[model samples]
Target: MKSPLAGLSKFDFFGVLLLRIGVGAVLAFHGYPILTGGGSVWTDVGKGAAIASLPPSFFEYAGLASGILQFIGGILLIIGMFTRGTALLLSIVVGFAIANLIAAGSFQLGFLAHLQMILALLGLVFIGPGRLSLDRKGI
Candidate 1:
């Protein structure tokens, strides 16, 4: 006999899709002001200064790349195109940010934001794009 879970419908896919898009949208929205408006002063001037002081270029590149990657990944994720790949990429970016933040001895609010992104990434990885997603055609 089939497992009881076999009765699940494709409607569950929409749940996943909504989660991915909604979370991605929130993340993107949060970043938008920081990137385009005066908010960057707080983020860039405050954080960027210390980040720029890192020894190697990799750390600096990684720091700069995180915002760019996050913007791109958040857009892709919201659109549901290459959802898994984008989520995975976001996870990597957030993971690196978390590591750097910890290493820098600042674990208060930064850690919480990183953790939120990680949870969202994990949700996308497990639930996938769902039925409302671009990837649904393949399923």
Candidate 2:
């Protein structure tokens, strides 16, 4: 069967671009403090993991890994380079953030924000970066 997206138009491209930039900006902002702040962020992550009864090593590695992924993935998303892969990775990070929030009993705006980020990233993964992206050899 033919792909449903075969008829994608310029408007679809613009929409995807908007979503990509918005999601990327949010991820980058969140990741920035963690990247520059040092191990304190990981310590908090470890504390949360401990409270959640997760393995200690998870905080050690996953914390660092998530930070790097978010920062780099956000940049890639903004540039529209490797858009699908970047969105997929960032979606995973957002999923983890939601899980962490739930485990910490943080049923607040932060959780909602991460949930939205996850949805947006997943949308990008499915819809692609659009014709205006580097992925499409556009400026």
Candidate 3:
């Protein structure tokens, strides 16, 4: 027998909206500190995204770019504007974060957070913002 909520497919858009807002808010919250903290803070945070043998100087720029993208993309996703593109870029950012977390030898809440977020972001990339979004007419 089908569950009562089996009909909830009609609410798929709401699911997308929830995903966007939730992920966007998180990105914005985390990005804000990096942006406001300037180069010094960026250098510290960029270590997460660092590739092999890259210097601290590279991290400064990487962090700066990541911060900008996270804040802007987060805002865009919240409003359902440019949802797919934002999700794609944010996926890369999350990828780096996940890699860093793994390399650091930890299995904390952050691991779960990034894991779920990446999955959602990738799904959003394919599923889009849906009918209730700015990309569609019902905004």
Query: Candidate 2 has what TM-score?
Result: 0.79
Model 3 lDDT tens row, 4-88: 9999998888887888899899998888887888988888778778875987799998889888988888998898998899999
Best-fitting candidate, scored by TM-score: 3
Better of 1 and 3 by lDDT: 3
| Candidate no. 1 TM-score | 0.67
Go through the candidates in order and give each one's C-alpha lDDT.
0.69, 0.79, 0.88
lDDT of 1 by residue, 1-139 (tens): 8788766764676677678878788767765654454433335523533455565544444445556666667888887888888888878766766776777789798799778879889778777777776777755
| Candidate 2 ranges with C-alpha deviation above 4 Å | 1-10, 46-58, 137-139
Question: Per-prediction TM-score, please?
Answer: 0.67, 0.79, 0.89
Show the lowest summed lDDT stretch of 10 residues, model 2. 43-52
lDDT of 1 at 57: 48
Off-target runs (Cα >4 Å) in candidate 3 are 137-139
Clashing residue pairs in candidate 1 are none
